[model samples]
Target: MMRVKPSAFVMLAYLIFLLLPIYWLLMMSLKTNTEITSTFTLWPADLTFRNYQTILTDPSWYMGYVNSLIYVGLNTLISITVALPAAYAFSRYRFMGDKHLFFWLLTNRMAPPAVFALPFFQFYSAFGLIDTHIAVALAHCLFNVPLAVWILEGFMRGVPKEIDETAYIDGYSWPRFFVKIFMPLIASGIGVAAFFCFMFSWVELLLARTLTTTDAKPIAAIMTRTVSASGMDWGVLAAAGILTIIPGALVIYFVRNYIAKGFALGRV
Candidate 1:
């Protein structure tokens, strides 16, 4: 028999417990609502893919995915672009209230999303950005940019000041040195930061649902309207949940090597 420690078994059990709900959701997606409600089993009594079929064929359903991707992509790009310079500044310089300013930035991320929802909605409405993908992207940036900066700053601090000084001594312009020499050094931090940005924007429902009606409705919002006179469509709801997890999984797969290094410092 293979040897195993008591702690190993405990960890294995915890892993199974955590994964059981995901496995059950997959099982439920392959079942009909009637089969789902009538019995309880580890596997579906009648396995069918009609729930996935329904979502794939419906424009409203698939468009939810598209709209979500658009805004999430936009938000990630916007956050990283803005945060890179800010993170570099905080990492390299000692200026007035720098530490306090950094803490204040995190406070934006710390605030409850619901607290700002009404104000964001009103602000976007006045700018003619309501019910658009950009509106949702901008709203998410309120929180994403701060988090990106904080994480990136940690990674940047791990870099030595000598690199910046040497680049300047070589007569490289500031922008060129930052782009050519500096960014490549902190690539892992950027990957981790982008991963977080994508996840937060992808899973966020409060601001996304509140800001858009039809034109920019996200998959998270679309999942809510499956209720009917008969009742909620459990099969479809489970299917939607399964699909929503795929993008995040893919992101992690690509960034698996860098994630640990990305969060190594700055109290991450």
Candidate 2:
């Protein structure tokens, strides 16, 4: 028999430590309440699909996921759109207090979501925009825009200034150059920025829960419904947790290469 390396054992232990919770959640999702509460098996003794069935068939459960996707998508689009020009300006130009302005923008991202939650609620309430997808999307932009700008600026700065001059000399209009020539050069950066924006908006519960009532309630808020007169719906909650991980997993899968490039600071 071959001897196992200590490092391999450590790596295996680390993986188990990381994956144990997820595995437990999956097991719980497959078990009924009785099996879950009474038994402590590594795998489900009596597997059931009722929990997943309930979530898929119920509008309230399904709609929470829809609402989350809507706001997260909207927030990602708005953040990337607003950050592009702002990042370009910061990367290529200098003006009065430009550094200060950039720092101030990042300060907005540093601030806790709770600090702005009440103010956001009041502002949206005044405009009658509460409980809408746009409201949550806009609220998330407060943080996402700054983060997107900071990230995109780093990648933009990695690009040479000669490209802009060359494009301008070729009689390329500003919009034409930015969209056609410049954007593609920093495509990986954009992917990284969009990924962060989507993740922040997707996982952020405070602003999403605080801003919406029923109409635009996100899955994060709806997950609280597991507790009731009948006690906690552990099976359904676990199933929902599994479903929640899928979208983010899919996103990371598609952008894995771009994300790798981003880690290398946009190098070829």
* Cα lDDT computed for each candidate against the true fold: 0.92, 0.93
Q: Against the hidden reference, what TM-scores do the models get?
A: 0.96, 0.95
TM-score, candidate 2, is: 0.95
User: What are the runs in model 1 whose C-alpha is more than 4 Å off?
Assistant: 263-268
Worst 10 residues of 2 by lDDT: 259-268
Give the runs in model 2 whose Cα sits over 4 Å from its true position: 1-8, 260-268
**Per-residue lDDT of 2 in model 2:** 100
lDDT of 2 by residue, 1-268 (tens): 9999999999999999999999999999999999989878899888899999999999999999999999999999999999999999999999899999999999999999989989999999999999999999999999999989988998999999999999999999999999999999988899999998998899999999989999999987898999999999999999999999999999999889778765553444
List clash counts for every candidate, in order: 0, 0
Error of model 2, residue 186, in angstroms:
0.7
Q: TM-score of model 1 relative to the true fold?
A: 0.96
